[model samples]
Structures are given as C-alpha cells and as structure tokens.
Target: MTMTDQRRKEEGTLASLFEAERQYAPVPSGDWMARMEALALEEQPAPRPAVPAAPAPRRRSGWREALRAFGGWPAVAGLAAACATGVWIGIASPETMTTLMSSDSSSLLSALDPASGFDYAMLGL
Candidate 1:
C-alpha cells in the first residue's frame, strides 16, 4: 500500500474508536457534587481498634557497656598497663627520664646516620 493510504486508514480507525468511547462513557448526574459532599459529612466507620503500641525497648548504658562488649578481659589488661606506665612516669624523677630519652635518641640518630648513610642536605636541612 502507498504511505498516504496507510496513514488515512490509521487516522479513520482512531477517530471511530474515540467516537465510540464518547458515546458509551457514563455522564455524572448534576447532583454528583452534592452526593460527594454528603459522603464527606457522614460519620466515618469507627477506626479499627488501635493496635496496642509495642513496649519501648530498654537501652544499654553507654561507654562502659560498649568497652566491656568490645574487649572484655583483654581491654581490662590494656587499661591496667596504661595506668602502670602513667604511674611509673609520674613517680620517676624528670631528670632521669630526660637523660635516658636523650641518650637513646642520640644513639638512634647516630645509628641511622652511619647505617643508612643518608644525607640531610637532600631534605634542605
């Protein structure tokens, strides 16, 4: 078939279909608005009995419970070690720690310099 003929046939079919729909479509009465208003004003059926609210869940107390859950005995041991280290530093004379740290640092610096032979000049030191 030619393009024009096919196009004409399709258009005629669509036009007939729309005409059939218009003829059969239900037309609402003029009182549709009044009927709708009455439905809106009428008491609605009682709401289905409210389902009882579930009991609120109990909340766990914060940090302490979290720490216990996460680490248990291992966590306790780590805390004890930290506390002991703090106490040792607090009790020791400041001069003693300074001297020890200074010597250790010097030894480490010397070892790194001689063993690696790295030049500080490369770092713009």
Candidate 2:
C-alpha cells in the first residue's frame, strides 16, 4: 500500500507517542510487587510431591513358608493322603490293620526289608 504524506506524518506522531509513554511508564512500588508475587503464588499450582514408586512385592510367610518346609505341593499332597488314610483306618478300625499292628515289629521289619539278606560288609566300601 502507498502511504500518503499525511499518513506518514501520523505514523511518526504515533511512534513518538508510544516512545514517550514507554519512557514515562510508572515503576511498580515494592508493596505492589510483593502483592503481585503473593497472588502469583496463590494462582500458580503447588509443586506436587513426587509419587512414590510401587513397593517391591513382599515375601510371603506363614502357610506358604510351612508349605515350602513340607517339600512343596506334591509332598504336601502325599502327606495329606497319608494323614487321611490314617484317620480312615482309626475311624473304621479295619481288621487287617489291627493284625498288622499286632504283629512283631522285628518280623515286620524283616518282612518289609528286601535288603535284609544282603551282607553290606561284602561291598568293602
């Protein structure tokens, strides 16, 4: 756009007015600055506390510890089966169980032990 001479003069006048206003701009007083600072602090969001990272998984104790002590799940299942059998026998009072319980322990050991006849000394370990 072509600027007329009048418009150029108006532009100069406007620039000078802006420069004068900038030069004569009032400095904020200390109280005003302090109040502004306080308002800024109020308006601005507070810094959030850092979120704690998720805690490490805790080691379990009690029943889980006892379960490990019993040689894990398979062993525990075997033990539970044995206990159930014992309870069943005690409650039912089976005839064969009574006979087995009454038999001599030495005779039972020899009967149950397949290695009874083997002479261990012959191995010369």
Candidate 3:
C-alpha cells in the first residue's frame, strides 16, 4: 500500500526471476589459478644481505712511549719544582703576607684603644 512496500515487492519479484534463470553449476577450472599463484610467489623480492662487522682497532701505548721519551723521573721532578715555586711565590709575596698578618688579634686591639670608649665587652675580648 505504501511506496516503500511497492518498491520492496518489485525488487523481490525481480530477484526471484533472476534467480530462476541463474546457473547453479560449479565453474570449470583451468591451470590459470596455479600459474597466478606461482607468478605471485616469483614476483616477491628476496631478503637483503647482512652488513659485515668491522674489526676492533688496536690499543694505544703512546702515553707510555711519550713518558719514556721525555725521561719520566726528570719530567716528574720538573713538574714538582714548578708547583713548589708557584706556592713559594704566593706565600712569600709582601702584599699577601702583610694582609694575612694584619688580620691578627694584636692588630685588631691596636686599632681600638681602651680610652676611646671602645666596647671590649661587646667584642667578648
């Protein structure tokens, strides 16, 4: 009665007619299926080759060779003397020693006199 029902009925009638005329027999096969499968397998590419590993390099003995070439004991003594010279110059310099000596208690007490109302009790001296 409705347009959709009429359309569905028409479709079913057409489908049944087509089914009545259709073949129900199995299709005959050829060697084409086997050939196609063989061709597909043949067309597949082969895997790539693996890369070769490199050899490990030799260890160095250059540091020992250099120390032997320079005469190791003399080289060590020269380095120690250079370090001692630097320390001696740092400690023996007049300006550095004067600054160190001026930081002593006697210098601090001389800077503040007893008659100058300087609070020694506050300094805990």
* TM-score for each predicted model, relative to the true structure: 0.27, 0.32, 0.24
Query: What TM value does model 1 have?
Result: 0.27
- Off-target runs (Cα >4 Å) in candidate 3 are 1-10, 18-30, 49-125
Ranking by lDDT: 2, 1, 3
Candidate 2 stretches greater than 4 Å from native: 1-57, 96-125
TM-score of 2: 0.32
9-111 per-residue lDDT for model 2 (tens digits): 6777586676668789999999999999999999999899999899999989899999999899999999999999999987899676567677998656555
Write out the backbone clash pairs for model 2.
none
Question: Per-model C-alpha lDDT, please?
Answer: 0.73, 0.79, 0.73
TM-score ranking of the models:
2, 1, 3
Candidate 1 ranges with C-alpha deviation above 4 Å: 1-67, 93-96, 100-125
> Candidate 3, after superposition: displacement of residue 25 in Å?
7.2
In the range 1-125, model 3's lDDT, one tens digit per residue, is: 99867765878868666555565645546787788889999999998898898888776699877778878989978988999999998878857456756788766555544533246556666
Better of 1 and 3 by lDDT: 1
Q: Which candidate model has the greater lDDT, 1 or 2?
A: 2
Residue 29 of model 3, lDDT score: 64
The global Cα lDDT (0 to 1) of model 1 is 0.73
